[model samples]
Target: MTSSAANRRTSLSAFLLGALLLLLLGGAAAVWALNRFPQVAQLAGLQPPADALVPATQPRAVATVPIGPQPLTNAVPVDALPATEARVATLEARLARVENATSRAESSAGRADALLVAFAARRAIDRGVALGYLEPLLTERFGPTHPQAVATIVTSSRRPVRLDQLAADFAVLAPTLKAAPESDSLWQTMRRQMGDLVTIRRADQPSQRPIATYDRAVARLNSGQVDQALAEAMRLPGITAAPAWVGNARRYIAAHRALDQIESAALLAR
Candidate 1:
């Protein structure tokens, strides 16, 4: 067959088949719609047989109960539960506050302990010095025998505060209190003189200036005049700039040592 004639024959067959399928589908759709709508089914020539119209008849009644009160549960009381819960909550809150307070108290106590230990160490060093125990000051002076010095002067003596802490306090008080260099320096110089005076009691020759100051102090003290000794001490150079407490401690410790030295000397002389 020719190509154009074959194509025309195929198209005619497809068109006739499509029209037959459409007609069948339309008829099926109308029958489905009539069944779904009973009213329309009667108009579409559908009807029930005459014997199907009658219906069975009957009646029934439902029984009802009279009204009554009812209990919710046999569970524990609301008042009891709330009271217990409230007690627990209060106790927990109080515990939290106590824990916080305990932590603060622990911190404060730790600081206080450290300060006290440092002060004790300072006092120990001062006492050692007065008694001529060089071991405390010079234990680590020679070389690095250990990671930490066995006897650091600052830590060697236990006192009210560490040496560094004292230095810090001094730094603050000096500037804020308008403390004069002369005022503190005077005390410092007097303190050194006091040390020198103690050394004199030990028969150690210091500088000529210190020697002269010591001579005057000794003479005044020997004359049974406290004011005179102080007057002489104040006149010494560089004594005006020293802190009062440090100066006082220096003299006090030295004087105590001097008494010890004097007794030793007297015993030896005898």
Candidate 2:
């Protein structure tokens, strides 16, 4: 009888060991699947959605008065912000991401939308140096007119800077399919070929007829085209200072390049 009981116990232990092995194998498979499709929240239990997850919610449209009895200008509306500590914590985290982005241009364009989402994120503006770059994008993407764009930028940002650009690559393919493509499908395809949008290529260089111009130039002084930009700036109607476009060219013209933050500052000044 003791031997019989021992045999029964042995059988139970073997069964448990087999079950444990199966569980381990299943877990390994799940890890493999999860690594490939990161958006899947469930491990082989659910069908994955077709689209990858993007944070939903277009930021609520907010207006900054460019002109009013009290036009909002670099003013903190912290008093109007909600008083939830959790929300404040979330904002602090987001601000950290903006502060840590790879480049100034990237940080500005990538972070503006998210920053504007925080109802009172504007107050945090006093803490960093992103405002100058952020404004132009917010204005171009959201506002209908330059004046409105300018006003929105000036009022929303704690740091106000200038806006300058020689060419803009209005994505020809990007215009809403709801509109006609003829009016849309052209980008001097960018002086774009040059790479930076803040740098201006005389949209039409002595055109016999005309040229459809679309482009955006950004900093170096491009180093590659600094000499060219300088020559052109010298010829402009009545401007003396180095244009961001020319500065960018000059930057790229050399082996090592840095407009010394001049690109961003120049862009903001524009």
Candidate 3:
């Protein structure tokens, strides 16, 4: 029985030593874990100094609904495209007006240049030159109204008026015209022949007698009153010079009338 007790005591001591060794190895492992992981140390109630611990992150601020109007999702604003389009349209209208004005100004300048050329051509025609090189320019500017009018003017301008020569010829013709008349009485013919020689002298007074009337017609022709002269001469019957003078006077009147028409047209066009 004493031997059994001694073995039992030795067994108890061996068991105690084995338990102490295990407890010491567990404590050393826990210390190593605490050094490697601070979170583990904090969980175990071993907090580190404030400087040694990582800082905690703050909560992010969240955006709330806008106070007033919210912005649209479109990349361009809803009203912006229309406003830009209106501006473009306005600019385009302005550009069109400018272009139209420029075109009108250029047309006016071109017409004015053509008119100058036409006037020069008219002067040359008056000097008895042919229509020649300037005919196209005059036709473009003026002949559209009356094509024949241009031809009439050019043809008439080339003809000589010759009213002075016609007047001198009419002086030679007046005696034959006054000598006898089919429409006059014998007393009237005798009165006309005597009045041709007799001098009635009142400087301010005018005479309507046939001899005095023929004298007035000759005076009108000398002064270039061709239409008036021809009219006065036609009143006296049996004047041989009437037909030729009438033809020339009609031609002169037509040329001047055509010139006036072209000038008026040019002014109105401007």
* Consecutive 10-residue window with the lowest summed lDDT within model 2: 207-216
Better of 1 and 2 by lDDT: 1
What does the lDDT read for residue 161 in candidate 3? 47
The best candidate in terms of lDDT: 3
Put the candidates in TM-score order, highest first: 3, 1, 2
- Model 1 clash tally, residue pairs: 25
Query: For candidate 3, lDDT tens digit of each residue in 1-270?
Result: 999999999999999999999999999999999989878988778986656677788899999877998767767876799999999999999999999999899879866875686577657644555666666777777777767767776676456444455667677778765445676798987776786677576988666466767888888877867677777777665565356655766675576567667766665564
Error of 2 at 181 (Å): 99
lDDT minimum window of 10 residues, candidate 1: 138-147
**What are the per-residue Cα lDDT tens digits for candidate 2 across 63-169?**
87676577669875887456666689899999987867646657566455434422222332323234555555545533442344335334534432212222221
> Which lDDT value does model 2 have at 16?
100
Using TM-score as the measure, the top candidate is 3
Candidate models: Cα lDDT each: 0.50, 0.42, 0.72
Q: Each model's number of backbone clashes?
A: 25, 37, 0
Per-residue lDDT of 91 in model 3: 100
Error of 1 at 52 (Å): 42
Cα TM-score of candidate 3: 0.50
Candidate 1 per-residue lDDT over residues 149-227, each given as its tens digit: 3333333233322233333433444332222245457777567657656543435743335446545655655554434
RMSD of 1: 20.4
